[model samples]
Target: TLAPSAAPAASASPAPSTTASPAPTQATDPAAAAAAPPASVVAQYTALTCAPSDVRRSAASTDKAQDWIAACDRDGTTKYLLMPASVVGTDVKTASAGLQGGGGTTSINTGQWVVNVEFTGSGQGKFTRLTEQTIGKQVAIVLDGVVQSAPQTNERIAGTAQISGSFNQSDAEDLSNVLRYGALPLAFERSQAESISPTLGRDSLHGGLLAGGIGLLLVIAYSFLYYRAMGIVVVASLVVSGGIIYASVVLLGSAIGFTLTLAGIAGLIVSIGVTADSFVVYFERIKDEVQAGRTVRVAADRAWPAARRTMLAADTVSFLAAAVLYVLSIGSVRGFAFTLGLSTLSDVLIMFIFTRPLVALLVRRRLFSVSRFSGLSPKMIGGRAAAVPVATTRARLAKRPTPAGQKRES
Candidate 1:
C-alpha cells in the first residue's frame, strides 16, 4: 500500500471526468475566508484561464503531445492549476480500470493528513513513465474538469502514491472519496423531471392533519371516560403543551427553515402517547396514596415526589432516543426526531410548571371531594369511605352523659 514517490506520471492518469462543466471550489474554512481579504495582495495564481472540457475532450487530447489546460484548485483559494489534459494511460472508456482506490490518513512519518491513491498492475508501469517525464513539476489530478490536487512529483512510485498538502481532516476525506468513487459513481441517463401539483401537496397536508386529529380525540375520550372530572387536568396540560409546541414550531420555521412535513405530524401523534403516559403515571401514583387511606388533598401532594421522579426518568429516556435519532439520521427522519424531542421537553415543562401545581390546587376543591365527580375520591380509587375527623370523635365522647362519673370530673 506504500509506494515511494519515484514513479513517473502516466501519459494519462485515472482521474474521472464529469459530464457537466466543472464548478468553482465548494469548500472553505470560515476562518481562512475571514482572513483572505487582507492577504489577497501577497498571494498570486499564474495559470492562464482555459475553457472547460469533459471525457471526450480529455480522450481527444491524449493523441496530441501535450495540451495546457487550466483548472480551479480544490483548495479554498481563487488560484488555478495548469496540467496536461488527458485520461489516456487508464482505459479511456472505463476510467477506473487503472485505479484501485484511495483513502485519507495521517502519515506516520510526517504526522500530517494526506490522501493515498493506489493503481492497478498495468497502471503502475504507465504511471512510472509519466512521473519520470514530469519529475519536479506539479501534476494536477483532474476530476470533473477541476483539479482535485496538484502534487509535485518527487520520485518514481511503484503502486501507491501519497498526495500531501496543507489539508484538514474533512478536506482529506473529501478528496479520498472522490478518488475512491469515480466522478460519476453511477451512470444516470437523462430523464424528464416534474414537480407534484400544489393541489396534491395540499391534500397530503390535510390527510396528515386529519389523522393526527383522530388520534388525539381517541386519547381525550379515554381520559374523560376513565378519570371523569379529574380528566380536565389531563386535557388542560395537553392543551398548554400543544400551544407551546405550536409556537416553537412557528418560531423555528421562521428562524431556521423548519418545515413540518407529514413525517413530523406522525412524530407529533407519537408524542401524544408520551404525554399521556406522564399523566397516567402521576394519576396512578395519586390513586395509590388514596388507596393507602390518605385524603384527596394529602394524596395529591404526597404522591408528587415519587411521581415526578418516574416522569423525569421516562422523559429523559425519550428525549435521549430522539436526540440520537436526530443526530444520526437525515432527510425526513430527522424531522421526525426533532419534533419528538421537542415534545418530550415540552412534557417535562408541563409536568412541573403546569400539571403538578394544577392537581395540587384542584384536590383542595369541594368538586374533588365528590366521588361521582372526582375520580380521585377515596371510594373511587378503591379505598375505604371517608371517615369522620378524630377531633369530632373526641368531642362526642366529652359530650356523653355523666353516667360514667369519671368523665365529668375533668
Candidate 2:
C-alpha cells in the first residue's frame, strides 16, 4: 500500500542519496543544464521557494550543505525556479503508491480543462494530510529536472486532486498521459526521417479505378441485354449521374481538401447497382402494367406511383445506413460512407430529373407504339389480350325447324 509520512520542517535537509551520481544542487542557465542533462527521471514535489539568484550562488555547495535546487519552468512562463531541498520529501514513486485510474477532462463549473488524479481509498488520508501541511505554499512538481508545474495549495484535498491551469484540451490530455504512464527512461534526440515511394500508391489507385470501370461495364451490359430498347434510358441516366458525381468530387476536393481514397471509389462503384436498381424498378413496373393489358403509353404513366414508392424506400434504406456508418466510424470508412450517401442522393435526383421525364417523353413517340420495338410489348411481358363483352338479343325460330326438333322450347 502507498503511504506518506508527516511533512518535515521547511528548513530540514534531505536524506543521503544512494545513487552513483548526486543530483545537481543548482542549474544557473536553463539551456546549459538542459544540454548537459541528468541520468535520472525522478519526479519530486517540494513546498519551498528560493530566489533564482540565491540558488546560483549555492551551486558549489555539497549535497548536505545545499538547501535549494534550481529548475526550468515547463511552459516557459518562468525561465528559472528554485525550491528547498527538504520538501522534496515525496517523489512520484511514493506519491503514486495508491494511484487509481484518472484522466483529463474539462471542469463543469468553469469550462476550463483540467486533469483529475484519483488515489485509492487507503491513500485518501495521507493525501489529505499532505495538502494540509503544504497549504498556502507552491507545490513544485518537478519531472526530468524541469518544473512541470508549481500549483499553489489553497486548501486540503482528499481522494481526488484536480490540477487546473491555463491548459488547453491537448495540454491537459498530454499531462494526463504522462501521469498514467510514467516518465520515459531515455531522452529524445534528433534523427533522420525517411520518405516513402509513391509507386505503391499509384498501383493501388490504378487497380481500384480498373475494378470500378469493370463493374460499370457489367451493369451497362446487363441493362442493355435485359431491358432491350429501354436500356438507352439506363445508359443515359448513368452518364449524367457520373458527370455530376465527378464534378462534385472535384469541387469538394478543391474546397474542403477531400481526398477520394480507394474506399471512396468502392462506394461510387457500389452506387452503380443503386442507380441500376432505380431504373430497373421503373421498367419492371411498366412491364407489370403491360401484362395487365395496358398500352405502353398508359402503362408508363400508370406504373409511376408504385415504382416511385419502391425506389424511395430502397434509397432511403441506403442513405440511412451510410449516414450511421459515417457518424460511427473514422478514417477511410468515413470516406466510404460519405461517398455512398452522396451517390444515393444523386441516384434519387437522376431518377426524378432524368430517367422519369425521359421515359415520359419517349413513350409518346410513334416508335414506342410498335410492340416489336418497345421493350414493354405484351408478348415479351406476357400481357393478356383485353376481353370484349358480347351482347345477346332475343330471336324467334322458324316453325319447320321446331317440328323437326319435335321438342322445342316455347
Candidate number of the best lDDT: 1
RMSD of 2: 12.9
Lowest-scoring 10 consecutive residues by lDDT in candidate 2?
15-24
Prediction 2 TM-score vs. true: 0.56
Model 1 alpha-carbon drift over 4 Å, by segment: 1-188, 191-195, 383-410
Q: For residues 68-176, what per-residue lDDT tens digits would candidate 2 score against the true structure?
A: 3444344333432332322222222222211112333222345656656555454345445556555554555444444444555567775466666666667657655
TM-scores for all candidates: the values are: 0.54, 0.56
Error of 1 at 296 (Å): 1.2
Candidate 2 clashing pairs, residues 3+ apart or interchain: none
Tens-place lDDT digits, model 1, residues 1-410:
01111112223433222111111212112232233322222231232222243333432332221323333443323234233332232311122111212333223345555666556566455555555554455555555544565566666555555666565667667766655554432345569988878899789889988998898899899998988888899889999999999999999999999999888988898999999999999889988887777788998888999989999999999999999999999999999999999999999999999998899888888888656668887777655565534653343444556675365565
